[model samples]
Target: PGGVGRQLLQKPTPAPAQHPPVRYPLTGEPRILFWAQNFSVVQGSKWVDLTSQTFGAEASVDVSGSSWSSNDSRLVLKYANVLGSPLTATFHMTSRWFPVSGRDWFQLNRLELATPSARPTVFNASQVTAPSNYSWHCAHLSSLPGFGAGLRGHGPSPSWGVLLQDVQVPAGTPGFSPGSGRGSGREGLGGVLAGACLDEPFPPP
Candidate 1:
Protein backbone atom coordinates (compact mmCIF):
# COMPACT_ATOMS: atom_id res chain seq x y z
CA PRO A 1 0.00 0.00 0.00
CA GLY A 2 2.79 2.46 0.82
CA GLY A 3 4.68 1.72 -2.45
CA VAL A 4 1.47 2.14 -4.52
CA GLY A 5 0.75 5.54 -2.84
CA ARG A 6 4.34 6.78 -3.54
CA GLN A 7 4.06 5.87 -7.23
CA LEU A 8 0.74 7.72 -7.55
CA LEU A 9 2.21 11.05 -6.19
CA GLN A 10 5.39 11.85 -8.15
CA LYS A 11 7.71 14.70 -7.21
CA PRO A 12 6.93 18.00 -8.91
CA THR A 13 9.45 19.98 -11.00
CA PRO A 14 10.92 23.20 -9.62
CA ALA A 15 9.51 26.43 -10.94
CA PRO A 16 11.65 29.21 -12.40
CA ALA A 17 12.60 32.21 -10.34
CA GLN A 18 10.46 35.30 -10.61
CA HIS A 19 11.63 38.91 -10.20
CA PRO A 20 9.59 41.82 -8.86
CA PRO A 21 8.97 44.93 -10.93
CA VAL A 22 11.77 47.50 -10.73
CA ARG A 23 10.98 50.95 -9.34
CA TYR A 24 13.76 53.08 -10.75
CA PRO A 25 17.39 51.96 -10.85
CA LEU A 26 18.05 51.80 -7.14
CA THR A 27 18.21 49.10 -4.52
CA GLY A 28 16.23 48.66 -1.30
CA GLU A 29 12.77 50.16 -0.66
CA PRO A 30 11.41 53.34 -2.25
CA ARG A 31 10.93 56.45 -0.09
CA ILE A 32 9.10 59.74 -0.32
CA LEU A 33 11.68 62.40 0.48
CA PHE A 34 9.14 65.13 -0.25
CA TRP A 35 5.50 65.70 -1.16
CA ALA A 36 2.66 68.21 -1.64
CA GLN A 37 -1.09 67.66 -1.90
CA ASN A 38 -3.65 69.08 -4.33
CA PHE A 39 -4.01 72.83 -4.99
CA SER A 40 -6.41 72.67 -2.06
CA VAL A 41 -3.35 73.51 0.07
CA VAL A 42 -3.10 76.83 -1.73
CA GLN A 43 -5.98 79.18 -0.98
CA GLY A 44 -5.45 82.16 -3.22
CA SER A 45 -7.20 82.19 -6.58
CA LYS A 46 -5.23 84.75 -8.64
CA TRP A 47 -1.94 82.97 -7.84
CA VAL A 48 -0.75 79.95 -5.91
CA ASP A 49 2.81 79.21 -4.81
CA LEU A 50 3.96 75.94 -3.29
CA THR A 51 7.54 76.03 -2.04
CA SER A 52 9.82 73.08 -1.28
CA GLN A 53 12.72 74.33 0.83
CA THR A 54 13.11 71.23 2.95
CA PHE A 55 15.59 69.15 0.96
CA GLY A 56 18.78 70.69 2.43
CA ALA A 57 20.68 73.91 3.00
CA GLU A 58 21.91 73.71 -0.57
CA ALA A 59 18.28 73.50 -1.69
CA SER A 60 16.16 76.64 -1.74
CA VAL A 61 13.16 77.71 -3.86
CA ASP A 62 11.55 81.00 -4.85
CA VAL A 63 8.43 80.30 -6.82
CA SER A 64 5.19 82.26 -7.22
CA GLY A 65 2.95 79.44 -8.47
CA SER A 66 2.51 75.74 -9.19
CA SER A 67 1.59 73.42 -12.07
CA TRP A 68 -0.93 71.41 -10.14
CA SER A 69 -3.82 71.13 -12.57
CA SER A 70 -2.01 72.02 -15.76
CA ASN A 71 0.73 69.98 -17.42
CA ASP A 72 -0.30 66.85 -15.52
CA SER A 73 0.83 68.27 -12.19
CA ARG A 74 4.51 67.96 -13.08
CA LEU A 75 7.44 70.26 -12.38
CA VAL A 76 11.20 70.22 -12.83
CA LEU A 77 13.37 72.15 -10.40
CA LYS A 78 17.09 72.57 -11.06
CA TYR A 79 19.43 74.16 -8.55
CA ALA A 80 22.49 75.52 -10.21
CA ASN A 81 25.91 76.22 -8.60
CA VAL A 82 24.23 75.04 -5.41
CA LEU A 83 24.86 78.01 -3.14
CA GLY A 84 28.64 78.25 -2.53
CA SER A 85 29.47 74.89 -4.10
CA PRO A 86 29.52 73.89 -7.77
CA LEU A 87 27.00 71.07 -7.75
CA THR A 88 23.54 70.69 -9.26
CA ALA A 89 20.51 68.43 -8.87
CA THR A 90 17.22 68.19 -10.71
CA PHE A 91 13.99 67.30 -8.95
CA HIS A 92 11.53 65.67 -11.32
CA MET A 93 8.16 66.31 -9.74
CA THR A 94 5.24 63.98 -10.50
CA SER A 95 1.89 63.26 -8.85
CA ARG A 96 -0.65 60.58 -7.98
CA TRP A 97 -4.22 61.20 -8.98
CA PHE A 98 -7.50 59.86 -7.66
CA PRO A 99 -11.03 59.76 -9.05
CA VAL A 100 -13.67 62.13 -7.69
CA SER A 101 -17.16 62.63 -9.16
CA GLY A 102 -16.04 61.26 -12.52
CA ARG A 103 -12.99 63.51 -12.53
CA ASP A 104 -9.41 63.20 -11.24
CA TRP A 105 -7.49 65.42 -8.85
CA PHE A 106 -3.81 65.55 -8.05
CA GLN A 107 -2.57 63.75 -4.96
CA LEU A 108 0.80 64.17 -3.29
CA ASN A 109 2.91 61.40 -4.77
CA ARG A 110 6.40 60.33 -5.92
CA LEU A 111 9.39 62.35 -6.92
CA GLU A 112 12.16 61.25 -9.32
CA LEU A 113 15.68 62.54 -8.77
CA ALA A 114 18.30 62.87 -11.50
CA THR A 115 21.81 64.01 -10.79
CA PRO A 116 25.10 63.88 -12.64
CA SER A 117 25.51 60.39 -11.18
CA ALA A 118 25.11 57.20 -13.15
CA ARG A 119 21.69 56.27 -11.76
CA PRO A 120 18.56 58.09 -10.61
CA THR A 121 16.65 57.90 -7.31
CA VAL A 122 12.88 57.72 -6.77
CA PHE A 123 10.97 58.99 -3.72
CA ASN A 124 7.65 57.28 -3.14
CA ALA A 125 4.96 59.30 -1.38
CA SER A 126 4.15 56.54 1.11
CA GLN A 127 7.66 56.01 2.47
CA VAL A 128 9.31 59.30 3.49
CA THR A 129 8.25 62.29 5.57
CA ALA A 130 8.74 66.03 5.46
CA PRO A 131 12.33 66.67 6.48
CA SER A 132 13.21 68.98 9.38
CA ASN A 133 14.76 71.42 6.93
CA TYR A 134 11.47 71.73 5.05
CA SER A 135 9.83 75.14 4.99
CA TRP A 136 6.66 76.36 3.26
CA HIS A 137 4.54 79.50 3.04
CA CYS A 138 1.01 79.22 1.58
CA ALA A 139 -1.30 82.21 1.26
CA HIS A 140 -4.64 82.85 -0.42
CA LEU A 141 -4.79 85.38 -3.17
CA SER A 142 -6.01 88.77 -2.03
CA SER A 143 -8.91 90.22 -3.95
CA LEU A 144 -8.03 93.19 -6.12
CA PRO A 145 -11.44 94.85 -6.11
CA GLY A 146 -10.73 97.04 -9.11
CA PHE A 147 -7.76 95.58 -11.01
CA GLY A 148 -8.90 94.14 -14.33
CA ALA A 149 -11.80 95.01 -16.61
CA GLY A 150 -15.13 93.59 -15.42
CA LEU A 151 -13.32 92.20 -12.44
CA ARG A 152 -15.60 91.64 -9.49
CA GLY A 153 -12.85 90.33 -7.20
CA HIS A 154 -9.38 88.84 -7.73
CA GLY A 155 -9.48 85.07 -8.22
CA PRO A 156 -7.80 82.41 -10.29
CA SER A 157 -8.90 81.80 -13.84
CA PRO A 158 -10.23 78.45 -14.97
CA SER A 159 -6.93 77.43 -16.53
CA TRP A 160 -4.51 80.08 -15.20
CA GLY A 161 -4.19 78.97 -11.59
CA VAL A 162 -1.97 75.93 -12.06
CA LEU A 163 1.36 76.07 -13.92
CA LEU A 164 3.72 73.14 -14.46
CA GLN A 165 7.09 73.05 -16.15
CA ASP A 166 7.07 71.80 -19.75
CA VAL A 167 10.38 69.99 -19.51
CA GLN A 168 10.80 66.26 -20.15
CA VAL A 169 12.74 63.99 -17.77
CA PRO A 170 12.87 60.56 -19.33
CA ALA A 171 13.89 57.60 -17.18
CA GLY A 172 16.57 57.16 -19.81
CA THR A 173 17.31 54.21 -22.06
CA PRO A 174 19.67 51.44 -21.01
CA GLY A 175 23.02 50.95 -22.78
CA PHE A 176 22.20 53.89 -25.01
CA SER A 177 22.63 57.31 -23.42
CA PRO A 178 25.61 58.66 -21.50
CA GLY A 179 26.51 56.63 -18.40
CA SER A 180 23.59 54.23 -18.96
CA GLY A 181 25.03 50.73 -18.77
CA ARG A 182 26.00 50.52 -15.10
CA GLY A 183 24.60 49.23 -11.80
CA SER A 184 23.19 45.79 -10.89
CA GLY A 185 22.93 43.44 -13.90
CA ARG A 186 23.46 46.49 -16.11
CA GLU A 187 19.78 47.44 -15.53
CA GLY A 188 18.98 51.05 -16.40
CA LEU A 189 16.16 53.29 -15.16
CA GLY A 190 15.36 54.42 -18.68
CA GLY A 191 12.67 51.76 -18.94
CA VAL A 192 11.43 52.38 -15.41
CA LEU A 193 11.56 56.13 -14.80
CA ALA A 194 11.07 57.44 -18.32
CA GLY A 195 7.46 56.25 -18.46
CA ALA A 196 6.74 54.65 -15.11
CA CYS A 197 4.20 57.24 -14.01
CA LEU A 198 0.82 55.87 -15.04
CA ASP A 199 -1.45 57.99 -17.20
CA GLU A 200 -4.66 59.45 -15.84
CA PRO A 201 -7.13 62.20 -16.75
CA PHE A 202 -5.29 65.50 -16.93
CA PRO A 203 -6.30 68.95 -15.61
CA PRO A 204 -7.55 67.35 -12.48
CA PRO A 205 -10.63 69.02 -11.12
Candidate 2:
Protein backbone atom coordinates (compact mmCIF):
# COMPACT_ATOMS: atom_id res chain seq x y z
CA PRO A 1 0.00 0.00 0.00
CA GLY A 2 1.13 3.57 -0.62
CA GLY A 3 2.35 5.33 2.54
CA VAL A 4 4.49 8.40 3.38
CA GLY A 5 6.69 7.34 0.50
CA ARG A 6 3.73 7.86 -1.82
CA GLN A 7 3.01 11.26 -0.31
CA LEU A 8 6.66 12.26 -0.66
CA LEU A 9 6.70 11.12 -4.28
CA GLN A 10 3.32 12.65 -5.17
CA LYS A 11 4.53 16.21 -5.70
CA PRO A 12 8.17 16.71 -5.02
CA THR A 13 8.96 20.27 -4.02
CA PRO A 14 10.46 22.28 -6.86
CA ALA A 15 14.00 23.45 -6.06
CA PRO A 16 14.13 27.22 -5.72
CA ALA A 17 16.04 29.09 -8.43
CA GLN A 18 18.48 29.94 -5.68
CA HIS A 19 18.25 28.12 -2.39
CA PRO A 20 17.41 30.08 0.74
CA PRO A 21 20.34 31.98 2.27
CA VAL A 22 19.58 30.31 5.57
CA ARG A 23 20.96 27.13 4.08
CA TYR A 24 24.53 28.45 4.27
CA PRO A 25 26.51 27.80 7.40
CA LEU A 26 26.64 30.75 9.81
CA THR A 27 29.81 29.73 11.60
CA GLY A 28 33.33 29.32 10.16
CA GLU A 29 34.78 30.84 7.00
CA PRO A 30 34.21 29.08 3.67
CA ARG A 31 37.27 27.21 2.41
CA ILE A 32 38.35 24.18 0.36
CA LEU A 33 37.82 21.02 2.41
CA PHE A 34 39.38 18.29 0.25
CA TRP A 35 40.30 17.44 -3.35
CA ALA A 36 42.18 15.20 -5.79
CA GLN A 37 42.86 16.20 -9.40
CA ASN A 38 45.15 13.55 -10.89
CA PHE A 39 42.67 11.63 -13.00
CA SER A 40 42.29 11.75 -16.81
CA VAL A 41 38.96 12.28 -18.53
CA VAL A 42 37.09 9.01 -18.90
CA GLN A 43 33.41 9.78 -19.47
CA GLY A 44 30.47 11.58 -17.93
CA SER A 45 28.08 10.36 -15.29
CA LYS A 46 24.48 11.48 -14.73
CA TRP A 47 25.86 14.51 -12.84
CA VAL A 48 29.67 14.64 -13.11
CA ASP A 49 32.34 13.89 -15.66
CA LEU A 50 34.00 10.58 -14.98
CA THR A 51 37.82 10.51 -14.60
CA SER A 52 40.42 7.82 -15.28
CA GLN A 53 42.61 8.46 -12.26
CA THR A 54 42.98 5.16 -10.42
CA PHE A 55 44.87 4.46 -7.19
CA GLY A 56 48.53 5.13 -8.11
CA ALA A 57 46.56 6.76 -10.94
CA GLU A 58 43.24 6.81 -9.07
CA ALA A 59 39.91 8.69 -9.57
CA SER A 60 38.46 11.18 -7.07
CA VAL A 61 35.95 13.91 -6.20
CA ASP A 62 36.49 17.29 -4.62
CA VAL A 63 33.90 18.21 -1.94
CA SER A 64 32.79 21.85 -1.74
CA GLY A 65 29.90 24.00 -0.48
CA SER A 66 29.34 26.60 2.22
CA SER A 67 25.62 25.84 2.55
CA TRP A 68 22.89 23.27 2.11
CA SER A 69 19.20 22.76 1.29
CA SER A 70 16.71 19.92 1.67
CA ASN A 71 15.64 20.78 -1.83
CA ASP A 72 19.20 20.03 -2.96
CA SER A 73 20.01 16.58 -4.29
CA ARG A 74 22.44 14.04 -2.80
CA LEU A 75 26.11 14.10 -4.00
CA VAL A 76 28.34 11.12 -4.66
CA LEU A 77 32.04 11.17 -5.75
CA LYS A 78 33.34 7.85 -6.94
CA TYR A 79 36.43 5.95 -8.16
CA ALA A 80 36.95 2.52 -9.67
CA ASN A 81 39.73 0.48 -11.39
CA VAL A 82 39.35 -3.18 -10.47
CA LEU A 83 42.20 -4.36 -12.64
CA GLY A 84 44.07 -6.33 -10.01
CA SER A 85 44.02 -6.85 -6.23
CA PRO A 86 41.01 -5.88 -4.14
CA LEU A 87 40.84 -2.11 -3.56
CA THR A 88 38.16 -0.29 -1.58
CA ALA A 89 36.81 3.05 -0.27
CA THR A 90 33.97 4.26 1.90
CA PHE A 91 32.14 7.55 2.63
CA HIS A 92 30.51 8.71 5.88
CA MET A 93 28.49 11.91 6.24
CA THR A 94 26.73 14.01 8.94
CA SER A 95 24.60 17.19 8.93
CA ARG A 96 23.57 20.01 11.33
CA TRP A 97 20.85 22.71 11.44
CA PHE A 98 20.83 26.03 13.36
CA PRO A 99 17.83 28.21 14.14
CA VAL A 100 17.57 32.01 13.77
CA SER A 101 16.64 33.19 17.25
CA GLY A 102 17.96 30.93 19.94
CA ARG A 103 21.54 29.75 20.53
CA ASP A 104 20.09 26.30 19.97
CA TRP A 105 21.07 23.94 17.17
CA PHE A 106 21.27 20.19 16.93
CA GLN A 107 22.39 17.13 15.04
CA LEU A 108 20.21 15.88 12.17
CA ASN A 109 21.71 12.65 10.83
CA ARG A 110 24.80 10.54 10.09
CA LEU A 111 25.28 8.06 7.23
CA GLU A 112 28.07 5.51 6.77
CA LEU A 113 28.95 3.36 3.81
CA ALA A 114 27.80 -0.16 4.61
CA THR A 115 30.07 -1.94 2.17
CA PRO A 116 33.76 -1.40 2.75
CA SER A 117 34.90 -1.28 -0.90
CA ALA A 118 34.03 -2.17 -4.48
CA ARG A 119 34.33 -1.07 -8.09
CA PRO A 120 32.59 2.19 -9.00
CA THR A 121 33.04 2.96 -5.32
CA VAL A 122 31.15 5.97 -4.01
CA PHE A 123 31.11 8.39 -1.08
CA ASN A 124 27.96 9.91 0.38
CA ALA A 125 28.00 13.72 0.75
CA SER A 126 25.53 15.71 2.89
CA GLN A 127 23.47 18.92 2.97
CA VAL A 128 20.81 20.51 5.24
CA THR A 129 17.93 23.01 5.65
CA ALA A 130 16.39 25.03 8.47
CA PRO A 131 13.02 26.53 9.39
CA SER A 132 12.07 29.91 7.88
CA ASN A 133 13.06 31.63 11.11
CA TYR A 134 16.54 30.14 11.04
CA SER A 135 19.58 31.84 9.57
CA TRP A 136 21.93 29.13 8.22
CA HIS A 137 22.73 25.45 8.02
CA CYS A 138 26.00 25.94 10.03
CA ALA A 139 27.63 23.02 8.27
CA HIS A 140 30.98 22.36 6.51
CA LEU A 141 32.94 19.39 5.20
CA SER A 142 35.38 19.75 8.05
CA SER A 143 38.36 17.44 8.43
CA LEU A 144 36.84 15.99 11.56
CA PRO A 145 38.82 12.83 12.51
CA GLY A 146 36.36 10.19 11.31
CA PHE A 147 34.99 12.24 8.39
CA GLY A 148 36.14 10.87 5.03
CA ALA A 149 38.10 8.42 7.11
CA GLY A 150 41.76 9.40 7.68
CA LEU A 151 41.77 10.88 4.19
CA ARG A 152 40.66 14.18 5.73
CA GLY A 153 41.64 15.58 9.09
CA HIS A 154 41.49 18.62 11.43
CA GLY A 155 42.00 20.82 8.36
CA PRO A 156 41.68 20.69 4.58
CA SER A 157 42.81 17.43 3.02
CA PRO A 158 44.79 18.41 -0.10
CA SER A 159 44.21 15.41 -2.42
CA TRP A 160 41.55 13.09 -1.13
CA GLY A 161 38.41 12.03 -3.01
CA VAL A 162 34.95 12.44 -1.46
CA LEU A 163 31.26 13.28 -2.11
CA LEU A 164 28.29 14.67 -0.16
CA GLN A 165 25.08 12.58 -0.37
CA ASP A 166 22.76 12.86 2.64
CA VAL A 167 20.44 15.88 3.14
CA GLN A 168 18.88 15.51 6.58
CA VAL A 169 17.86 18.40 8.86
CA PRO A 170 16.22 19.01 12.22
CA ALA A 171 12.62 19.66 11.18
CA GLY A 172 11.17 19.66 14.75
CA THR A 173 8.73 16.89 13.99
CA PRO A 174 8.01 13.49 15.45
CA GLY A 175 10.10 10.69 13.95
CA PHE A 176 12.61 13.33 12.88
CA SER A 177 15.52 11.85 14.79
CA PRO A 178 18.80 13.64 15.52
CA GLY A 179 22.05 12.65 17.30
CA SER A 180 22.75 9.98 14.71
CA GLY A 181 26.53 10.14 14.10
CA ARG A 182 29.89 10.26 15.89
CA GLY A 183 29.96 14.05 16.36
CA SER A 184 26.21 14.63 15.95
CA GLY A 185 25.47 13.14 19.39
CA ARG A 186 26.31 16.61 20.70
CA GLU A 187 24.61 19.90 19.98
CA GLY A 188 26.17 22.34 17.49
CA LEU A 189 27.90 19.54 15.57
CA GLY A 190 28.09 18.86 11.84
CA GLY A 191 30.08 19.66 8.66
CA VAL A 192 29.67 20.94 5.08
CA LEU A 193 31.40 20.69 1.69
CA ALA A 194 33.69 23.65 1.00
CA GLY A 195 35.14 23.13 -2.53
CA ALA A 196 36.15 20.64 -5.18
CA CYS A 197 39.72 19.68 -6.14
CA LEU A 198 41.29 20.94 -9.35
CA ASP A 199 41.70 18.56 -12.28
CA GLU A 200 42.95 20.64 -15.17
CA PRO A 201 46.39 22.26 -15.21
CA PHE A 202 44.72 25.63 -14.96
CA PRO A 203 46.66 28.45 -13.30
CA PRO A 204 46.14 28.96 -9.57
CA PRO A 205 44.25 32.04 -8.43
Residue 165 accuracy (lDDT) in model 2? 22
Worst 10 residues of 1 by lDDT: 133-142
Report model 2's TM-score to 2 decimal places: 0.21
lDDT of 2 at 28: 56
Estimate every model's Cα lDDT from 0 to 1.
0.27, 0.27
- Per-model C-alpha RMSD: 21.1, 18.5
TM-score, candidate 1, is: 0.24
TM-score of each: 0.24, 0.21
What is candidate 1's lDDT per residue for 116-183, written digit by digit as tens? 63243443332211111121111111113232111121222321222221111222111112112123
Compared with the true structure, what per-residue lDDT tens digits does model 2 show for residues 26-106?
Answer: 235311111222212211222222323321223242223222333322222233332222223323323334455443322
